[model samples]
Target: MSFCSWFKEEEYRNHFEPGLYVCVECEYELFSSQAKYEHHTPWPAFTKTVHKDSVSKVPEEGRPGALKVSCGKCGNGLGHEFLKDGPDGKMSRF
Candidate 1:
């Protein structure tokens, strides 16, 4: 079995499956599966935000380069991404 198969089990589908899922913590949509997510040394692994309009980096008025990915519905921290390959084999910024 491959490393990703271990997470393909039904039990982890809600949390690790590859697809569009909603973040219960932030209510933002988690587009990629755990399989596509990579440990980029910032957070618990990272993946693209799925929807470009779903996230954005705006001027914080005081801080520069201060960008935050928030929930589309609630505007909470859904995490950020970098230019990387996703599990789908597409070049994306996750």
Candidate 2:
């Protein structure tokens, strides 16, 4: 199985239900599946965080004018955030 599938399966087996996601190390609740959607990207995508303090967006290194999302609690690099139009035709940062 693909790495994504394996990771998702482990999440499922661990009773990580929809609308909830936590950091592996700190157990800091991060993204909500409510904001999650298929973006056809290699990794999982979410429209927003469950709370504003859940993550911190920092300027990416060696990538001028780019942003990277990191875990607020443990400072883990979650992913990058993109400012673009969402599926709902609204401005979104994901």
Candidate 3:
């Protein structure tokens, strides 16, 4: 099965409050409170990562047009990243 198939649409559209988020297994800090934003999507959204190396992007083989976002350290699947227009009128990763 494809990795992207493991997740439901609702998983990506959920909302989260502003707070620190870490990897469940390694407790590696992934995102900070300031990065959280409401994209009105099923999954929690963030404006950016806590650091440049906090997350890694893997190309989805089954879904050629999609990219999977994973934890940089433990390689846990976080979600997907998309180019969305942010409040600043610039394309932002979410």
Candidate 4:
């Protein structure tokens, strides 16, 4: 998916209020703002989900280790995530 289509370029990006990010299509709780971080990318990046099963990851074809993320509650396409080493010297989902 394109970056513009996957993200909401609104108050959520610059704002840092602690809360949950819900799906636009289904209003399903996806991730918490607490785990949200800046990856120096144009899109909002999150390091964690609200629950272990909040989002489902499907392996992307022709892309090793890159998974497409979607809302587990409603199957709405959210974005893509990867398991990468965080800047804090720990492993995280980004």
Candidate 5:
């Protein structure tokens, strides 16, 4: 199956407990539940990503508040995330 298809499946969507997934663009091994799926938007988003180097921040485009992130290697838009107050009283981006 295609890499995007694998990630889009309902079984894998938002399910990070088992810790399985590889960065499609870089083929990097990512085994952390730190990444999660949020339905706030269309594409998948993680509460915490792998690392700054693993992804690239895309400048706001189109709309006034269009924050986006994309794969460094392929330039495929991963998703957008925003910082908000977490339950722990700490600011988090998800």
Candidate 6:
């Protein structure tokens, strides 16, 4: 059995799943499912943010070059953003 809850996970490889992804605590729009991509990792990955100025960042204490990102509206920590292979073969964003 599959544990994926995404509506169209059956065909959403490196493509948005056809809905919205938001912060669980704040319900603020984070990224469009269409911006989603298969990162081949446990965490859901996005190509970019759907809303502008909706995120905040702080330097991670232990990680030398990592920046932790959070929801600007509710101050909820989202995750850390670092360079990775983007869908366009370029570095991706938070």
What TM-score fits each model?
0.43, 0.67, 0.68, 0.74, 0.52, 0.70
Top candidate on TM-score is: 4
C-alpha local distance difference test of each model: 0.44, 0.60, 0.63, 0.65, 0.47, 0.64
Over 41-60, each residue of candidate 6 has an lDDT whose tens digit, in order, gives 44566777778866777777
Candidate 3 residue lDDT tens string, 8-86: 6644334455568887778888887677665645456567778788888866677654677788899988766644334
Q: Count backbone overlaps in model 3.
A: 7
Worst 10 residues of 3 by lDDT: 1-10
lDDT string for model 1 (1-94, tens) is 0112223333332345556656567667655564344432323333455576555543444545334455566665544333333334443453
lDDT of 2 by residue, 1-94 (tens): 0013323432332332575887777889887767666554455656677777888877778876456777888987666655443446453553
Could you tell me how far off, in angstroms, the CA of residue 76 lies in candidate 6 after the best superposition?
Answer: 0.7
How high is the lDDT of residue 86 in model 1? Answer: 38
C-alpha-based local distance difference test score of model 6: 0.64
Error of 2 at 83 (Å): 3.6
Clashes of 5: 0
Give me the displacement of residue 66 in model 5, in angstroms.
2.1
The stretch of ten residues in a row with the least summed lDDT in candidate 4 is 1-10
Clashes of 6: 2
lDDT, model 2: 0.60
**Top candidate (lDDT):** 4
**Reference-based TM-score, model 5:** 0.52
Ranking by TM-score: 4, 6, 3, 2, 5, 1
lDDT over C-alpha atoms for residue 81 of model 6: 60
Per-residue lDDT value at 33 in model 4: 80
Residue lDDT tens for model 4, 1-94: 1112433454455656888888898888877888777554455667777877778878878877567778888888776655453435344553
